[model samples]
Target: METLITDIKIALGDNDDFFIKRDYLIEEEVVFLGLNTLLDITKTKTTLQKQTESLILKGKTTQLLFNLIGDVFENDTKRAISSILEGKLIIFIENTKQFIIYEPISKSINRSIEIPTNENVIQGPLNSFTEDIDTNIGLLRKQLISKQLIVHTTSTGMVQKTNVSLLYLNDKVDQKLVDNIKSLIEKNNDLEITDLQGLSKMLEFSSWDTISKFNTTELPFHASQFLKRGRVILFVNQLPFALILPNLIWDMFIVENDRNFPFPIMIAIRFLRIIGILVALIAPGLYVALVAVNPEVLQIELALSVAQSREGVPYPALVEVIIMLIVLELIIEASVRLPKSVGQTITMVGGIILGQAVVEAKLVSNLLIIILAATTIANSTLVGTQSTTSIRLFKYINIILSSLYGVLGLVTGIVLICSYFASLTTFGKSYLYLNIERKDNSG
Candidate 1:
């Protein structure tokens, strides 16, 4: 049974990080194996000693007993060795086929919690939340005080146990939703969950899911509001934001802070946001369709102006749109990656210089400049990064369809988008469910 362990040692070829020791865990004799380079030696041993004792006392055999970032692997020579490379400690029973992967405390990350400089909110709420789990929960605890307020903490990841805290109003929260979430967390107890996107997989959302299943925010007030409305707030260790489940379609248009404004003003703003959504989804496709495939759809003067703006451009309307879109995406990516001072200068100067240069060079039409600029601006109007990304994905579908079938393709794209949204669900609640209210219906 220790042949697997023997094989790993040979494969590693006498590395300094690879070390083993004879030990007794829970009165069971075993050998401890790990890489010293990856593990914080003192913390790793301490966590396993305490957490394993708790697991046994709680009548659990398997859990965060391996590499902190990986899962419980099969009894294979390669994977056993791979787990060691991924910063996991393996506990092999001397004569048994069983082996437990103990928690590996990773090297400390050197950084202090800072406010999010990336995202901007119109109706600003104070976000004093930080990376530390205790500090974040303490912030939320101050805002939510009730007997039913449950903050259930658990560990995930096989390599290292990352803390996950579930905050919900027990009396108000739907039991089914909580049960379902807990079950997934338990099922994947040995799997690492570092981000909400990975958590989506735990919820069984497939690759085709364009709309994010949860809403994320850094503000304690926002998380508290969602909890009161019978929604769950999931806090991942070191994640600066709290993940609010069942990200509904309305989240694109409505936010809790907006209610501070007068009702009519909120309504007007929401209406404009909806219009922006449509523009982001349809503008590029509509422009291509009208210019290339359905010129007669436009009035004579408008069509003439469009044609004149496109003069001397050497590519088809679709290619021209794609070229310009790629440039826009490059600029956006660059802006995000560069420093703030540099990013602003790059975006401002890049947009002006590039836009003018492309038009003069006839690489793209002048009319497309107006449409794609509007598209980029409208895309920014959506609430979440995930929402904007999902909507942005649909434009490619629309572009392809419209290039083939004109106005009919754009209509087809719209219908498909609607149907997709209608079928989306998060924890059994419809994605389209807007207002926060209690209901018995899970369908």
Candidate 2:
């Protein structure tokens, strides 16, 4: 260990300060002090004894002794020695080579808890999770006061030393789902698993391919409900949200408070969001088909009105709709990136001004303006921005296909979207369609 430490010092150079020493038994108790100027020896002893005694009691260590700032050598070496030199304390026995590293992490930076800005609900708690892992766990424990709740913590990242926890209910969760999640986590050993999104991508079986595989939410109550329904939740250190697995596509459309509402109302809201998703994705395509090639399909009065509205416009129906769609999308992107106050103002001004100006300039028909405005409003109701953006993209694809090939192309696009969605699965479970086996668990 001494030679290894010495070689490491030379290899690492002055970039890192490493001090090691040997322990000599003094007065029945052993004492060896090994620390660089980087460590505060005055408190290292206290932190060291506090960290290792439990491991020693568990029969993992035979003896412990303080090492001088330079006494450490090959006699008691471990790879964790570098961490010890960096303010962590390492305790080694005399005969064997295994050692335990303790981190008395400095509590220097303090962060105050703030209300959740993005997911604010008028009735729920204003408090939100912070960067601290323990604090986040405490928040969950408070919400789910149950003995069956199991939280398994493991160290992830060799250098990052990030703490990741797998939380689930003991009896309710399926064992196979837990095993599958563990398998994925173990396989991605060397990949950087820092953020929740990175961890999600690594755990995804089809990460390199196109697939909607997992569900993530910031609401704690939403997580608690999922735990009760036999799903696995992954909690990453410093991340405000947790990832829930084996997610059904229908699950995302259901809100956290849906179960609290009357059954009829819940069903209505869920169906409404589903309808909104359809409108957001296909409204423009429908408008293009009707106005561009099927104006006779509409009744006489409506057809005449549309014809009169577009009489002064120079562009074709498809071009006019696509142009307005692009402008609306730009406004939406800008609103999302701006501050909340500014976002509201931008949405209002952009919606009213652009809508009126386009009609006044005879750029697009009045009916198409209404269709585009409805499409934008429908897209905003989705819970997650990721899913919303995805649906928005699909909307553009639908518009392009309809513009080129008319009504039949819109039908073909629908079939293709259904086929793509149906082909996705997470760990052998269906991702898009609902399972009727558990008919009573819709809530």
Candidate 3:
């Protein structure tokens, strides 16, 4: 027993937080090992005393003690050390190389469940996921009360061992998809995944790819909806959001709030969102293409007006577009990094001042400003922030292509983008496939 204690001390080193409490259980001496900062020492001691007293009354035997404890592990030093590090109270019985591990009352500092700040909805559940994995799973279970909803949890990260949960509907989801995901996770068990982004990078195997193959949401109801639609949801330990796999092209225009409205209204709103996405992606590029290469496509009056707007501008259309795009992007990034109230003020002030000043200074044309303003507003209608960012980035491709080949270049860029989307796959599922059909019996 003394040797075991010495080994534990050596493994933990001289860390100030490491602690050991020695107690007597009848004729045997029991030692408790844990971290002072992590364990609720008072509750742990009380429970230990009560359990030991009861075991003594029943039978003072090693087999009886093991049966009472229910978590006995035979002499494994490494496992004992790991359990202690994870805040579990490790019990060492004298003369018998056995350990019992259990969790005691400790400070669980987790954010209170509150309304989602970013993914707000008018007619759905308001509560969002908190940082606690148990709380998040409880919220999901409350919303999706079904026996088919399976949650498989495992710990990743060799050093930290962060908890990861894979949630899916057993009856609806394809078994092949589940196997693929589990295989990927098991293969990367050595990775140190601290957040959703890190886990996503590990799963996707690329950090440079701007497109997200998963739909991330903080709302449990949203996650439940996706699970019913044959999608798998992944939850990380400390992340407040859940990731839905096999992100489809249709996901870009989906708005969860639209479901609250009437059927016709929902359809119209979704159709308009699709139009908004298209306009956001191609409006600036089309404007530049028409002015630079295909002015004949415009009516005489509009063409003359556009020409008049550019009369005093010094830079060419392409350079002017690039400059305005950069300024707009900078304003956006600044607003996001600033406080909420300050961000709103800065965005409004920056947009108004910069737009007016640049046009008056002849750096850019008035028509271009209007086109860019419309484009920016339309870009916000995309479902997820990631999709919006990807669209914003891809717009530049269209702008450059239009500058090179006018309208034809814009067409080519759009075609290439569609091709890219079509070619992309997540967990062997095509990005373009919506997975609306029922799975086969084999699935």
TM-score of each: 0.74, 0.77, 0.92
RMSD of candidates 1 onward, in order: 8.4, 5.8, 2.6
Worst 10 residues of 1 by lDDT: 61-70
Candidate 3 global TM-score: 0.92
Lowest lDDT sum, 10 consecutive residues, model 2, at 24-33
| Evaluation by lDDT, superior candidate among 2 and 3 | 3
Candidate 2 positional error at 134, Å: 3.7
Model 1 TM: 0.74
Per-residue lDDT over 49-151 for candidate 1, one digit per residue giving the tens place of the 0 to 100 score: 8866776776664433333323444576665676677677777766676676555787755245455553565675666567778778887888787788898
Candidate 3 local Cα displacement, residue 433, angstroms: 0.8
Error of 2 at 33 (Å): 11
Task: Give residue 206's error in model 2 in angstroms.
Answer: 2.6
Clashes of each: 9, 20, 0
Residue 342 miss distance in model 3 (angstroms): 2.4
lDDT of 3 by residue, 6-50 (tens): 889998968999988888655567787898788788887787678
Ranking by lDDT: 3, 1, 2
Distance from true position, residue 62, model 3, in Å? Answer: 7.6
